[model samples]
Target: MSLRYKSAEESRVVISELMLPSHSNFSGKIHGGYVLSLLDQIAFACASKHSRAYCVTASVDTVDFLNPIEVGELVTMRASINYVGRTSMVVGIRVEAENIQTGIVKHCNSSYFTMVARDDEGKGIEVDGLLLENTTEIKRFLKAVKRIEMKRKRREEFDREDFVPEDYLSDLENYKVKVTCTDEL
Candidate 1:
């Protein structure tokens, strides 16, 4: 069979939901966990649309919450295929919250989810290649590539048998941690 390709627009998914009182946390703001759930849902939708198959989340590579969302606000999430590999795709999501009363919108979070397509038997399957059509799409794809490389390097460095905690101890000197068990470590 010939290889299939798709533009990011073909798989883009956008969802908007009203934040309810039940979605608020102790601080009276929408709980972060609730937002994460919506992000994952959109990511799955986008990936499945792109591959035309069942997809499973391989990882939540990044989630940055820039602003707090409040109850009674309208939360909108936009998801698109940012990068595609043999069997996996990186889904980029942008979240925003709009205060209905004020009509002001705030960027709440930006996230990246890695999803892998699966066949009927649940084995990983090849996904269609991404056709970058514009500069923004190209940039998103490139950023995903860099993020994957950085994550791989971080895992390799920390998982090495010769890894040393002391080597990175000094790197945290400026942080707020006290390191109470430094001697034990």
Candidate 2:
């Protein structure tokens, strides 16, 4: 493993796999979880290779299941390291399924996964990052940035739900006690 990494634009597919019957659902269609796991595996490889360290999942911005893949079809999921941060790297993954025998293909899903690179002591480390030499991959890195921002803003907003002011009144009658309990919280 090399510590020098290329920019996001230079990230490329690290690995791929053909979907098998064991990876499908009861309906004989590839299961979303199975596909997700495959995406994670590929992304992990891309991140680990670039960062030259252990990479773990921090978050998945989104995954759109655009189509279905039958058990006999060949599902190819390609993952690329699209962006790098102080402690995190973003990987873009696209999945497509093709009828191996018929030679027909369809886009199945696409997503961005955020990964944290950790040293042997479980501390943060810098990644080699992608070179981002092309327009398409540059766009992907930009998109990953945007996706991360959106998810972050959403998390900030959602965190407010974890607390409620005494006067906010979960129930009108229950709003009486204003006692502060600091230790457990």
TM-score of each: 0.94, 0.78
Q: Specify the poorest-scoring 10-residue window by lDDT in model 1.
A: 176-185
For candidate 1, list the clashing residue pairs, or say none. Answer: none
Cα lDDT, all candidates: 0.96, 0.78
> In model 2, what lDDT does residue 183 have?
41
Candidate of highest lDDT = 1
C-alpha displacement of 137 in model 1, angstroms? 0.9
TM-score, structure 2 vs. true: 0.78
Candidate 1 residue 21 C-alpha distance from true site, Å = 0.4
**Candidate 2: RMSD to truth:** 6.7
Best of the candidates, TM-score: 1
Q: Report clash pairs, candidate 2.
A: 5-128, 6-129, 6-130, 6-131, 7-130, 7-131, 7-132, 8-130, 9-132, 10-132
What range of 10 consecutive residues in model 2 has the weakest lDDT sum?
164-173
Could you tell me the lDDT of residue 69 within candidate 2?
78
Superposition TM-score, candidate 1 onto the true structure: 0.94
